[model samples]
Target: MDFDEAGKSLSLEKDEYIELVEFFFPAAEIDINKLMTANEKGDTELASDAAHSLKGAAGNLGFMELSDLARSIEERARNAQVTGLSLKIKELKDKIAIIEEAFEKHKNS
Candidate 1:
């Protein structure tokens, strides 16, 4: 939740970085849903696509934790390995929720 560091990496003001982060949340949630659905359907290729998209987006925004999680999922999917993906997806969701909560606290402060 180092917004200052993230803003520096992106060359954005704090408020601008926050704006992008706010925009990313819902879109990321959609991607997560797509990943979950794809996983349940055993669509590894589709899941990989979703995970790759999320990794790229998160990495670009300096959210490395999210990017790394997504990358792991992507790699597993690319290998056609669907084992324990539900647990990984849940972990990703938990991280996202924690980040969102921190962001809300930042807003209030």
Candidate 2:
């Protein structure tokens, strides 16, 4: 959640990075919901797709923690391994919440 580092790594100014993150937050929430639904339905394909999308977006924004978590889910889903996905999805949501809190702090500053 190092905003300065993320902005530097992405070659974005602080304001630009903020704008990108503002967009990312809501989209990430949607993806998380999709992941939860996919897990509940045991739809490996849909889960994999959702995780992959979230992974890529997070990585692009230098949210490596989130990206890594999503990558695990994507890899598992790709192998049709649905076991414990609910827990993993919860972990993902937790990471997202942490990131959101950091973003809020940055905005308030």
Candidate 3:
């Protein structure tokens, strides 16, 4: 992710950018976790809700990859398509790892 670009587009200072990212980190993590659990249980509504939340949060933070994956999962879950839900969930989880790594690097820096 382009941290500098995102911060500039959002009109945030460095510290403010980090703070905003920090605030969103856990929410996105939790929602992704919930999405997986909901998928496992065939809970379409729950999964869709979690995916929707993750999609918005990821997009807001300029995590475009995550945002796009979350959107795919959201639409699939809403449509009750469980055929490839696990794979989609796995992809979303992988994208979450990217943000987690970025957040860790930001914290360490």
For TM-score, the strongest prediction is 2
lDDT of 2: 0.93
List the lowest-lDDT window of 10 residues for candidate 2. Answer: 1-10
Q: For residues 1-109, what per-residue lDDT tens digits would candidate 3 score against the true structure?
A: 6686888888889789888888887887799789888988889999999999989988987888889888998998899998898998888887777767977886687
Off by over 4 Å in 3: 106-109
Q: Against the hidden reference, what TM-scores do the models get?
A: 0.96, 0.96, 0.90
Scored by CA lDDT, what does every candidate get?
0.92, 0.93, 0.86
- Cα error, residue 64 of model 2, in Å, equals 0.6
Q: What ranking emerges by lDDT with the best candidate at the front?
A: 2, 1, 3
> Which whole-number lDDT from 0 to 100 does residue 20 have in model 3?
87
Sort order, TM-score high to low: 2, 1, 3
> What is candidate 2's CA lDDT for residue 78?
95
The number of the candidate with the highest lDDT is 2
Residue by residue across 1-109, what tens digits does model 2's lDDT show?
6798889887889899999999999999999999999988999999999999999999999999899999999999999988888899999999999899989998998
* Clashing residue pairs found in predicted model 1: none
- Model 1 RMSD to the real structure? 0.9
